[model samples]
Target: MMHRVAGAPLAFAALRSQLEVPGDFAPAVRAEAAQSAQTVELPPEDATDVPFVTIDPAGSRDLDQALHIAASGDGHLVSYAIADVAAFVRPGGEIDSEAHRRGETLYFPDTRVPLHPPELSEGAASLLPNQVRPAVLWRIELSGDGSVRSVDVRRAKVRSTAQLDYDGVQAGLDRGTLPDPIAALPDVGRARLALARKRHAINLALPEQSVTGDGAGGWVLALRTTLPVEQYNAEISLLTGMCAAQVMLDGGIGILRTVPPPDKGAVQSLRRAARALGISWPDGAPAGDVLDSVDRSDPRHVAFIEHAVALLRGSGYTPFNGAPPSQPLHSGIAAPYAHVTAPLRRLVDRYGSEICLALRAGIAVPDWVRVALPELPEEMQKADHLAHEVDRAVVDATEAWLLRDRVGDVFPAVVIDADERAGTVVLDSPAVRARCAGADLPVGERIQVRLVTADVDQREVRFERADSSQL
Candidate 1:
């Protein structure tokens, strides 16, 4: 189910150069990171006895989090440890200045532009298995119903007992051989999912298109479906973020990841699309509920889910000092959330983690952190924009390369979106989504589309309706 595209490496290299992506770290930053990696002191509090394990994609070096869950009475006790990037990067120091300039890690199919030098991000500061590293530990006690009863976060020295990947963990769970450290994940994850449904949170089960190496020096484009264990792991992270957001709100100062509620007009449009697609929408069901009911195996259902993506818009970081912002909820999550779980990859998480730790310890927020809060949102926004551009451009170019030899061939596709004269289509064979041009393209319907143009240099791929094309 994967298609190998030729000449992708050269095309991607040219694209990166054109984007002016940052290269290796500056010499001063590298030297500072190397020294700090060797000499940084571990926190006094030791949680190394806790058997924490990390779950991420295979071969991920810059690990950010490790977790262990256990039964606490009828509920569960979750011990989450996040990499403490601040331990090695001093305020206004070389590494810190370089990280601020980078904003966040930029990921491409071939490689990544790390936020910090490898000496720290991939070495000392990473939560690699058996390594005693500094961490921001979150100890959360949850009720039987999965509601958080109490939360605490602080610095500590911790060690990960194992490094797990999603596929392996899910396989272990399926065989009833999962380790004890995270055996409670399914129970807690199911409970939390019930709560999310009750709160009308949107959970889109859409397959993501990704490009990877084919091992023979070519690029393969494929669709990756989310495994059940991945959802459970994500729920744990969400719980911590919600807890952090509450702590910051109580302290009256911090930044929040916020999104406005879906617009009424957009909701109506989605309802109309559902009707056109022959999907049922009850009188009182929320969009999330309606989406959850759809069978993802159906092509029409996939198209409808793609259309619902429009409901999530206007998301941005909201920084506040004295009073909390008017809108603080991440509508997709149906709760207030903060970015404090991935400090190694994201610049904002380090600052957010520092604020939460200071508030919990009853100490004044550091002046350096306070002064940087206002500018953090803009910096993160720019980084986010760049990341999106890179991902989209890379995919577009790869898709173009995949279809370069079949410009006149017609392929079966689903019209996921439409306007008066143009729309978007998803082809299943190659797992590609690109712009389609024709008159009155039907949305959420299977149709034949002919590839008209596939230009790797421009990262453009276009199709025309088979019936409308003159050939």
Candidate 2:
């Protein structure tokens, strides 16, 4: 299902221009941003002494989440702080409208089109290390067994004690020498993951491809595995989102991130896929449990995980005012959830955090947040579509450029999917997936594939079965 014409441009300039992305802010947007720094009010709580630290990519400045975990009486207290984006952008202002138009931050290869102006999202609102920032703080208390005991949301002022990345944190954890204040992340994260599994949470195992500088005026696609501490860190955000959804449901007014359970047909298809791949998915085992047992480093298991991604679709934002929805589960997370973290990068989190705050404080939900609840679904859905398109386009373009001169080269590839017309094969060296015209391409089987075409202008690539191709 792909078309390729080699020797096109090696840069993303063509794709960015082709997509016609909004690359600059409007005059009105700029005007509002200049005033926001002075007009934006901060909350009246100073928790700077809590020793919170920002953990993100090595050089990332748009830090959205920071935390300080400690052992409380028979449990742990997780003081998770998220950037308070709503506090800076006034409702119906130019910044607000512009953010709605953008919906969310779009990250490309080397740059990003931020939802809000840099003054706020990156400079002021961001929780940079050692900087005092306003945040929507989640105070979650958990029992010894990792079950959540209570949750509280509030507006507060805080400062990050340090900025740490996953690799650094993992190294520290491995050596058992992380500073005392932040040493509790692994323990709490593992406990929370245990609770998630108890409720059937499904964590997909797939390597992600990232583009990095080649140091010669170009980029290279790198396939990286998700580190153990990274998953542990993500479990914190998941715990907060689940707590947010529960609060919204109990308060009877908010939006939720929802995904319906997989249907009988999807499950049947997955079972068939597993059998075709010669993977034994036990008859009565839950899909999550079966998936957790596979070694992801194996190509066959990668193909199985690829098929598993299809079972977790139909995701969307659902808003209600007077009552909770009957089916509000986010099947991927295996729990009810909402977007209450990463407000600096996302829009829904700002409104959801506001609603949760109001509900926690026994105050009326803000009129502005109430009005935006129903409208957020459409906005977020559209933004999500654009983000996905950009992501796919960038990857396709990069793959084409990387393979431009190797059209006749043969490589080992595993079959990810197959249909009557063609089968999708993934090459390990470049870590790119391309559809190859073939027959009897058994799913998950490793075979020789030759690159037939790679076109950067069209951002397409096609392959052929090297077993019988015109070598």
Candidate 3:
């Protein structure tokens, strides 16, 4: 059954206060924004001829990327324009220091703590439609078989023709009514996916749960499924990041988003869980392919994804000064990658993009950028930890709010993971995942569980095995 909460403040506000998230920008940061500075020396070359458009979630104001793809000699040409935040914020200035402190934007159901003040991140530096803006343009050329042939990055002035949300783009794709630039996406996106599989990229297609106001003074939790075009559009960003990593690696200096390859023991444990769940792993199949074969909507598949998280642990930012780091690969993407996208939201991307631009332009990297690289990994790592906790807390609080009134009700659930002390289970009705304390819980088997406790303030939900035959 669907659940609703009314006449109460969303727990996210309270949670944010508990976590000490800065609700407003510091006075210095705000005062600095009034005196906006421009840093680009050379005149930005005009690229407004391209019918570039922004694709993001509905109502997303702080847009980051815009693109136009076309047919090249054999494969395709992708002209991706990223917001030129570096051009707007002076290095080592008040805004720069504030952004470095924030690291990245933290999102929640009701509010967002932006990395930069709205006057810049959502205004001057933002790539909104019909507004001419400076951007870091990446003109990437791919071969006939989705192999990258060439890449060029430079400062340019561009104007977006349209600001499109993902839903609108998906609708256009479905009706076969998209313009040439948008229409050409499936061809390149499919090609890129093929290349990713060839390299064994593990792209988990997990459904995200989002809570929204239902317009009747209440909240509704919605599961947003990943769409084909969304995944394909992401591939373009991945391709650019891989190219950025290649440039930095050859230049012998940059921070890489690194993760070690999955441990043999972790993979073996997942294999055991799959067998017990009655799922087959084809003999000699790569991990990515085996993961792709399962249906994400199945409860057992969700369990499998949870188990696979163990293999993808130890993700971190590794900065190298003299030589490339020894562990340089982001095992999740099956490539050595640096974050050069989403500079408006992430602090590291601005530095990464500047390094790529300097290397491509044959100019010396700025002293400020060089000095900040080594210190970024630590601050970025801490911000990442906070972001993860905030996201989890918001979800937990929302789940607790939805189930607060259903304490004694029994619902069907599947045990996802188990131990002697406690086990994790997913309830069918409210679509909430929580813990269930019990004995002899069968993994991957449906059972009736009676809600034992639902504490809204504590952000907890607990259950125990029940006699389902009574239902």
Which candidate number has the best lDDT?
1
Task: Rank the candidate models, highest lDDT first.
Answer: 1, 2, 3
Better of 1 and 3 by lDDT: 1
Q: Candidate 3: global Cα-lDDT? A: 0.85
Q: Which has the higher lDDT value, candidate number 1 or candidate number 2?
A: 1
Per-residue lDDT over 1-471 for candidate 1, one digit per residue giving the tens place of the 0 to 100 score = 578887655466678788877788999999999999989999999999999999999889999999999889989999999999999999999988888888889888788899999999899999999999999999999999999999999999999999999999999989988899999998899999889998899888798888998888888899888999999999999999999999999999999999889999889988988998899999999998898889988878887898899899999999999988899999999999999999999999999999999999999999989999999999999888888888888888889889888999998988888889999998968989999998889887889999999987888999999975543
lDDT of 3 by residue, 1-471 (tens): 345665647767778889877678888887776567343343359898899988998888888899899999988999999998887788888889888888899998676899999888888788999988889999999998889999999989899999998888888989998767777788888999988888887767777766767778777776668888898799899999999999999887888999999989998998998897888898887777778788887878877877777878899998876788889999989999999989999999999998999988888888888999889999899889888888888878888888888898898998888877678888776878889988767787788898988898888989988874646
Q: Which candidate has the top score in TM-score?
A: 1
- Give the distance in Å from residue 196's predicted Cα in candidate 2 to where it truly belongs: 1.6
TM-scores of the candidates are 0.98, 0.96, 0.96
In model 3, which runs have C-alpha deviations exceeding 4 angstroms? 1-3, 37-42, 468-470
Residue-wise C-alpha lDDT for candidate 2, range 93-162, written one tens digit per residue: 8999888988899888678889899888878889988888888999999898888999888989989989
In candidate 2, residue 85 scores what lDDT?
88
lDDT of 1 at 34: 93
Deviation of model 3 at 221, angstroms: 1.4
Predictions ranked by TM-score, top down?
Answer: 1, 3, 2
